[model samples]
Target: MGTKFGSVIHRADRGTFRAKYTYHGEVITKTFKDRLSAEAWLNGERSRVEADKAGITKWTSPTDRKRQEAAVKRRRTLFCDYVMDEFAPTWLNYATDGSELASGSKRKHREYLQHLTHSFFWKYPLTSITTEDINRWLADLDNFGGATPRKKTFQLLKAVYSKAVAEGAVAKSPVTMKAPAVPKSRQAQIPPATAEELQTIYANMPSTTRISVWLGAILDLRIGEVVSLQVQDWNPKTQTLRVCHSADVNGQLKSTKTATSNTTQPVPPQLGKLIDKACEDKRPTDFIVTCADGTHITPNRLRDHFNEAKTKARRPDLHFHTLRATSITAAVATGASLKDTMQWGRHADAATSIERYQRASGTERMREIANGIEDTLMGHEPTREELEAEIQKTKERLADLERQLDALK
Candidate 1:
């Protein structure tokens, strides 16, 4: 009872044991509730002494041990290495559907990520980088490619660091600043072409490519979405086009971009006639728009056709996507609500509809807004007396509002 297996067991304390040993030339003693713990402590102390004799200094203080671990981590992991070895494989390829990222998206990520790995920050410790370093990197991008490139590069780095934080690889992201500002003058401004200009382009396009232009301008269909449509996706009786699939960046056909993108859009009679002309004598599996040899039209060939049409129309600034912008702007100008525009354009948010899609409306459209207000006020003829009384009440309300504002001041 006095001693048991490298521990002292007291007779009075039957369940507990005392452990004593020499560590770093000092006698270290501790009491343990069990022989196993006491024996473990004794063994650890003996190992530490052996390690010290072997020229390996074992850390005795908690602070010293933490410092040494941090140094070792910094030595092993660099920002570039972490992104290439860990983040890219584990996080970048991850998706909700358990599939890899779209080919086009991966290409863009790789392009922008180079801005980080090729810069001075690549050798920085993964966990040691601070907000100031991120800011400096963003600021230096101006000499490289100006504001837009700078913003893209910053976003890529921020995404990587955010993944690091989420996985507990780093405590927080060093990228805390807002996006770089792109001046309106420096931005690549593509104004929406008018319906007349679009019609001119349509008239000059070949029969096969005309269908593509019509779909883009009228239905706001993306180039990939238009080319991916099969003859069966069209309902001739209802004049509705079901957008179920699209071509990916690599020119391979896939499902639509988002769930909201898979929609049944109404087709105008003119556009429906165009589709019928293109799909004549074609089977249900056949693409509605095809090349001269009856093969599926790729995006590269579609761009060449669009370029020819743009030149013939004498609107060199117009690209294929300009037709989509024109359609969205035209939709807004025709008194469509923001919600209706979002649904029609397959947009996930109204901000994109208002800020990006809905371009500057002309003076005539401004007058249309005034006309709408006039119609609302003049819906029914009001008696002269009633109208005068309504005007007096409005004046009184304005006066009351001014009085309340003055009181607050």
Candidate 2:
């Protein structure tokens, strides 16, 4: 009486022995801990086996043997080798970088696939994996990186296995064996600094380095473009900086991120003056901006300077991207159109600019509403005194509500 759905073991060596058997053209092995266990186990399964395989017979197991058989039948397969051999091929290529994916994308895929290989996906045969296997995998994904990541990784795996099917490896992708859903919620980015904070950073910067910093943040010129400025790229007449090329500290010419990335950026008036002054002492043969050592600025040195600026401004969250973001925000706030903002941000999409830099504070929104009401009611906007008084009253109301909530807790 072997375990349910396993071979019936008649007898074996005194120690545990496994019996190999064929069922429906597939081989399976049934293990027995001892001869007595095998005999007692098989004896009970005889009638059931005969009923299943034979014309007629009735079988019943010894109570403990029946329990043991049930336990063995219920044991699950769990292994890593199965995934590498059966699932990893057609995709999961480490040769290609996944950096182009948005933030946390790589981390999500790595964690989910890692757990699948180590936990269960590799343990079972490709045919044995079921809807249940995929459901559990997605749940773990949700716990790790939220529902969006789980959904994304699920789609990624599905694509990987679809490729596998095309490669004549797996007959079909098992990704749709389970499907999970995430709620619809928009997650917009919260940029790290305001224009005031950015200007504060620029104010304390070294004069020699300040224009270079401003060129990147205010003009959104990439490091290469900022350092590569030739004296002739500046057009005082059009107030534009033609972005045909940019350079490294060594003035090495390299490709911009893309073909569209090779466009011009118009210099705002203030930024234009800084650039004008910076280009004043230029060698006709030299770049518009140079480092303190008088060589073209390197990306690393530009970042180092940006970091110094952040330190001076006491804003640790500032990055080169933040400077570029500040430039976009300033332009947008001053009523630049989306197309112009895109040109200034050098963003692949206008939505990216909106996502990364736009800040609509709740307090400012309420203030605007109050001021508008005052203007309509009195045919004039509120005085500073009226606005201040309103703000103080709102603060007290908020404090009282917070105190009440805290007391309840």
Candidate 3:
């Protein structure tokens, strides 16, 4: 007699059990020595079938498993140790010379790696880590910051594991889990400073940054674009400024943020004359906005200068970007169309100009609506011709009503 468990059969005469299951449209049979062993093997095969049906992964063939097993036997290095010696150098080279990532971005990724280095679980063998372990690590990063940082850290870890997989250090990556969504902040209206307030700040600023403030507030130039302005970019005859280049935080010259940003915009005559005066005795190669020694003014220097002037003017919240937003808001308030505002502000989209930069304070909007209702209630007297036409229409309506009343009587 033979004990049977679905397709698994234990043959008493042979003292062996045959376990069978369907794999890749073919029947696979394995022999075991005991009935319990046959049932256990059969259950595992059925589980693999269900997992494949659910689209998790295809069943691993015995040959493939043996090959992976051989590969795992050769992996002697732990993840932390391997990353420190081999992966770190490879990643640095890829991040710096072989990739398009910026220097600032590379620095941030390295900082996140330090967080991983502090975790004890990351010191384990790379091949031993499961997806559950990766998910738990992501949960641990929730204490670091908001969803954005958690997501970024997870992405960095994924990149590291992918590199490991490519280098044959591991069979596959265990970081297919998704991170939390980044929450969006509500946009707030930022009111522009008045002309008197701007003048006060401008007067108090140093000579090096005075022109910078003027260009930013009047022309609505980004802080990067303002600092990158050279003598040649300005044309006194046409009164147009060609915004083709900008400087990074490190004072490295690069193209504008977008193609639309590389435009020739008109400058007001007042600001044009100020630029002309500053350009006096300076060559085309010389930067129009620079330090006393004629070097390209870094973003840090510009921010420091602006902050001092802002504190003096009593507008502690004012920033260089605020000046740009203020200028765009003023232009829109004074009957500028959305298209025109977008062009002048160098916005790639109109929604950014209308929604983000435009300033209409809550109280100010309420006041305008209240004033409109009051003006409607306090009526104006009609002209004589308008009164006569209204009286004639009223008489005709009354006559029709009287005729209807007589017919009813």
For model 2, residues 61-173, the per-residue Cα lDDT tens digits are 34446666744443332224434555554235332343243222334556667644443565565445666677776667534467765665576556556655675445566
- Best-fitting candidate, scored by TM-score: 1
- All candidates: TM-score: 0.68, 0.50, 0.52
Please, what are the lDDT tens digits per residue for candidate 3 over residues 40-96? 877777777788789997878666777878677537567788777766765643443
Expressed as tens digits, the lDDT of each residue in 157-222 for candidate 1 is 887888788876777888889878766542226777876677788888767777788798789888
lDDT of 3 at 308: 88
Task: Give lDDT per model, in order.
Answer: 0.75, 0.62, 0.75
Q: Name the runs in model 2 displaced over 4 angstroms.
A: 1-135, 138-199, 222-238, 242-254, 258-260, 281-285, 311-316, 337-343, 349-351, 357-409
lDDT of 2 at 272: 82
Per-residue error (Å), model 2, residue 329? 2.0
- Could you tell me which 10 consecutive residues in candidate 1 have the lowest summed lDDT? 1-10
